[model samples]
Target: MAAPLDLDQLQTFVMICDTGSFTRAADEVHRTQSAVSMQMRRLEERIGKSLFEKDGRSNRLTEEGERLLSYARRLLHLNRETLAAFDDRSLEGQIRIGTPDDYADRFLPEIMARFARSNPRVELTVICEPTPGLVEHIKRGNLDLALVTHNDARQSEVVRREPLLWVTSANHATHEREILPMAFGRPNCVWRRSACDVLDRMHRDYRVLFTSFSATVIAAAVLSGLALSVLPECALRPGMRVLGESDGFGLLPDCKIGIMRGHTANSEIVEALARHIAESLDNISVPSAEEAPAFDLAALSAMRGRRHKPANLMPGW
Candidate 1:
């Protein structure tokens, strides 16, 4: 029988495909250029097919090599995951996770701090974006997990919905803008939609005075008394106060927080990570109605509308 395929040889092959140069691949794998060529020749002999085709001065994967590259990536991923699982609590593997920016700053830091207190060996890669982008990454398997606000068809078995709260300046009279000016995020943002829908349903005429995807910009707008914003209660701070709770305003729908697992049984690192996240959120002090801001519709409807709604208010939306 043919000798079992060598993992080192397959890895070298992948490096060659990545760099498109045996010399460069050799430098990366710490082998001589001739040694690298010899390894590839042996790999092709064992597999019964040439791995690459030489065209002019460039090297490209042969049809068979292209097919092998896919399996090579899978094998690498599986091998890494398996080793991580067998290793002790020293969870020293790369984890790519995505979440909304609001959560990244307000919620994730605390969770990560707590997790790191225990698993100092683990390395984390975090990407902060809106729900749509995060979901796309999860579907592409580029992210090990993501936290997103649940939407209609995007809702999954791995989702958790957190209550969203409407927040405005402390006193309606202090901020004398009749048309409840809103500081909004991109259209895909659930918080922005919730804020707009609440105003529309109540027959409140409002204008989005400032728009941005950055949480800092939205927070700054609200703090400067330029506009009001809807955010999670836990996200509120002294600079940005909540509206009154006794104003009889309708509460917006809960913001969905999802935790997706790309591989359920592949690695304990993922499970430990999920567990750490859950515990972190569970221990947080969620905002209650008493802590929510008050809203006055009669006062809000008095402001004037913008000259125009500003066409294409959201660029990518």
Candidate 2:
């Protein structure tokens, strides 16, 4: 019979795919680049197929490597789950976690549900604040974990990424205005500042019509047809339509979501929670830019002419 696949090797493989570089995967796996290369060589030999091919200076997965990736994740996840079932270090007591309100609304449900299933004895305490506040809480050891927008140079493990898109209410032609109306977060918010800077570079006519720290308030403004906002794909809702280059709004940077653990936190439980968060976010992506339809402003303008309408403005912080 064929020998069982090595979990460590598979894990290294997955990390390479996740990080898109051998050097990064080496750092993540705590192995030297040479050692990581050796592991992949052995893995490829065992599978009897070349797993990666050179694309310029970088490694691109071969068809065989892509096929192994899903299986590798499943195997590693199952391995973790099996060990957790018998581990005496199962989580108990209270775990304090923090996240921005926007993330708490969009991402907490999955993270919480997965966590609750594995550590039912643990009581979870959640705090909703902006990323800066959450970072402070984690740094002070007041929070055991924090989900944050990964922009600043900080100690964080980025777990998920998706496109940041321009958004406006589907029912309104508000985005068609001569001077674009916008809703944004607090003054210090990164997304708000970045979006404004990008608009300025494009020489777009826009006004920050509303400013609120609350994502709910900002979303309310957007839905009311008063303004346009920038948001990650996951936070999109039914009444919202994505705007693109066709709308004169240029592409924004990818939104990166990460987990930060407290400086002094429960090692076992915190690590477990982090793994669940990462796994839940894995292998997901927003549709490619090539797939976005060319939007027509004239249609929205025509629809606006028929509206006896009220006005409004909007989040990722």
Q: State each model's C-alpha RMSD to the native.
A: 18.5, 9.9
Candidate 1 worst ten-residue window by lDDT: 308-317
Q: Write the per-residue lDDT of candidate 1 for residues 108-204, one digit (tens) a residue.
A: 8777876665566778889988777887888788888777776667744343445466556654432345577888888877788787888788776
After superposing candidate 2 on the true structure, give the runs of residues whose Cα lies further than 4 Å from its correct spot: 1-59, 284-317
Model 1 root-mean-square deviation = 18.5
Per-residue lDDT of model 2, residues 180-227, tens digit only: 999988788778888988899999999999998778888898889999
TM-score of 1: 0.58
> Estimated TM-score per prediction?
0.58, 0.72
Evaluated at residue 98, the lDDT of candidate 1 is 84
lDDT of 1: 0.67
Alpha carbon lDDT of each predicted model: 0.67, 0.77
